[model samples]
Target: MHDSRAVPFVCPIDHGVLEAHGDWLVCVQCAQRYPVVGGKPVLLNEANSVFRIADYTGGNAYGGASAYGTAGDGSRGLKRLYHRIVYTLSESGAGPAAPFSASDAVAAVQAADPDAQILIIGAGETSYAGNITYTDVAFGKNVRCIADAHDLPFADGSFDLVVACAVLEHVADPARCVAEMWRVLKSDGRAYAETPFLQPVHMREYDFTRFTFLGHRRLFRFFDQIEAGISSGPGMSIAFVLRTTLANSTEHRALGAVLHLAGLVLSYPLRLLDHIFTRSNGAYDSASAHYFFGQKRETAIPDRDILQFYRGA
Candidate 1:
């Protein structure tokens, strides 16, 4: 269980300091009560967010539900099979080697400050250190808090490192969410994110956006680039397109599953092409995904200057 007091949590609405009151956290400014479910605080601004605090407190929120399937025991076997197919399809072709190590970033931050506050937004079964706080939109086994990325429920400049890996695409407003991330980070703090570019939609309704290498850099213009490049290559993009196409070809669930598996098998060889594609500068035009690791800066990069930094062929 996380010690809430250790975290610099604030009311999402007014950004006010909160006081614990029985089973709730009351905002000192607005006096609005937010529920503490189990041990994690469901800190959502009900008016601004699509999710309601009541959804979590009432145990109605569905954590990690994808558009592909429902969360039920009866579909567990099918879901397992579907996941296996995806894993096999994505294993080899997903991308090229990453330019930087995420773990190394965590270690460097910890080395700088042993008691550093690290926040992982949309952290799904990813835990880096004891000092890190894991937050998601819904309750999960590893989630320390339920938070909306667009309006993070934490004090400004409260964290040393903020990670939003593979999360921005799912949010309705990536820019606003990124701004919230910038807002919560201390001066010269670090931000790391991985967002899809050429990938097919998997999370269904939850997936909202995609960004190219240049677009990804533009998104984090507020951060001085430390290192940014393709995390997944063109091979993975081909595999994803094939699989999604076959899977959605028909309304028949059983047949669609079989076709999806077949797509994976058919595209297996094409996925291996990433080995060559990732080495070419031209691959940036069709790269599957991009990653950005940067530090917070007071000045945003000008649009014209950002265009000059484009590496695509």
Candidate 2:
């Protein structure tokens, strides 16, 4: 980065400080080099960098690029416009979801430094569909670094804010990913994460874990709770289940697509129920996805406290 305030990154492989060595980020200790492509540091460990980059840069980036979409601007504009309305209700459920709607995460970060260094985990191109690409409004223009969420390459307490939307489930170790995010944040820093609770598996097999509303709270128990609640309502969850059931019942990919499309159309109206259902007492039990936002602290979350956070399905 040209600015002196740029967040200097460490080497994820060895956790060693790295310096700009031509077009590479060279670790001062191991002398290993991580390539910088298109101004973004490829901070992933060697094991992931090789395979993941192929998909991240190529047109089919399901390997690990959740936020980063595949190439081509083909229908992105139309997709964004459509989802802007449809997705808001389906995922949000009820009145308003916390953390995901969370300007608080940004507020907490901005409180420390107006030009705070915020890091977005799994920041990459939009998905293969381009519908989920990064919005400049949410992630401000100051975000200058891009790296793997699981293995962040930054000195301890370097960032003011970290946001991971729909990313934890993709990583093999969500705990490790959270810990890494914590490690990079300043004590006053905050983090926001979102994950599905009842939604079907997505992003191929890369999709892994789903958490209860309370389970989501416990995920970031290490931090002081700013807010956490349903990001996507239960209506969307039921819709996905319907789509999944129909898709699995048939072997024909084309027919499966038709069924899923039809399911979504029928289900689209169901989300209106979320305005009531998401606010119901059983909302957490049937939530489509959840969001958690909190601030970092010095004390560790107690194991005993964690055990008691479940609200159940």
Candidate 3:
């Protein structure tokens, strides 16, 4: 439900309003033109432009694309296949919790500020219509654009809501990204955001970070309201690592599918087992993927204790 044309966007350079100019977007104030490619606006600043996801999965996805078959180190292909299996597992309600992220944060923000202008940072390769972003089924015209988190094109204080989902982990400088989010929000506006509290190796072009609950709280010290939600725990972590690692092995994929099916069949019973045996490892290691949000308030100020306690960037 993001409407790009509803709220006027400002130029990051001169704080000027922006207008769409053919293939490029122009800032009315500074006259800077940012190209729009494949419907995504590239708004990176000079300080942080080139971003890449780390090779967490060993290039399995890309390597396995050849219809003829794979050569070289097929590790990449395996990784890709592993993720495919993971998604399948997610669809079937198998493996650990589904990879929930800033998408939920976006919904939370929308709930708080229905008519506020919104921007999605690191809006990478995702479609707002059919993808995770607000679907036509959810919001009629809610979100406007999915722009890079580090380089937001809009002028300062132009957007009412900003969502930086699991994107901060990939950025070279998370602090700078947070500062930019703060800069773009109105004095009294709030941003709904979340980062992984517990996650494994992920390559979003580059996965450089992870956050603890306290760490997440600390990052949004500039906001008036900061609340942290729990995320994945030891048992779930083990399930993810086991399933992914097994799925990555050529010999184990077929086995992994069988395992996944077995997991699903046993899920209800295991869950019952978890309930009866609360002290068991599976029961003992439960955790929810944590989410935290902060609202910008004009008069309300940050507290020294919370700032000092959770200050992690």
Highest-scoring model, TM-score: 1
Error of 1 at 166 (Å): 1.0
Best by lDDT: 1
Off by over 4 Å in 3: 1-5, 19-22, 28-31, 38-40, 51-85, 91-113, 123-146, 247-288, 297-304, 307-313
Candidate 1: segments with Cα more than 4 A from true spot: 1-5, 65-95
**Model 3 TM-score?**
0.61
- What's each prediction's TM-score? 0.90, 0.78, 0.61
When summed lDDT is taken over every stretch of 10 residues in candidate 2, the lowest stretch is: 129-138
- How close to the true structure is residue 157 of candidate 3, measured as C-alpha lDDT? 83
Per-residue lDDT of 1-313 in model 1, one digit per residue for the tens? 4433356689998799999999899999999888898988899987767788888877787566322222332445867877755665655433446766567668878887777788989886676764888899866667888899988998899888899888989988999999999999999799989899999986667788999899999999999988888888888888889888998999999899788888988877766788888888988999888888899999999999999768877
Write down the lDDT of every candidate, Cα atoms only: 0.82, 0.65, 0.51
Better by lDDT, candidate 2 or 1: 1
Q: How close is each model in CA RMSD to the real structure?
A: 3.1, 5.8, 8.5
Q: Residue 102 of candidate 2: its Cα lDDT?
A: 39
Worst 10 residues of 3 by lDDT: 131-140
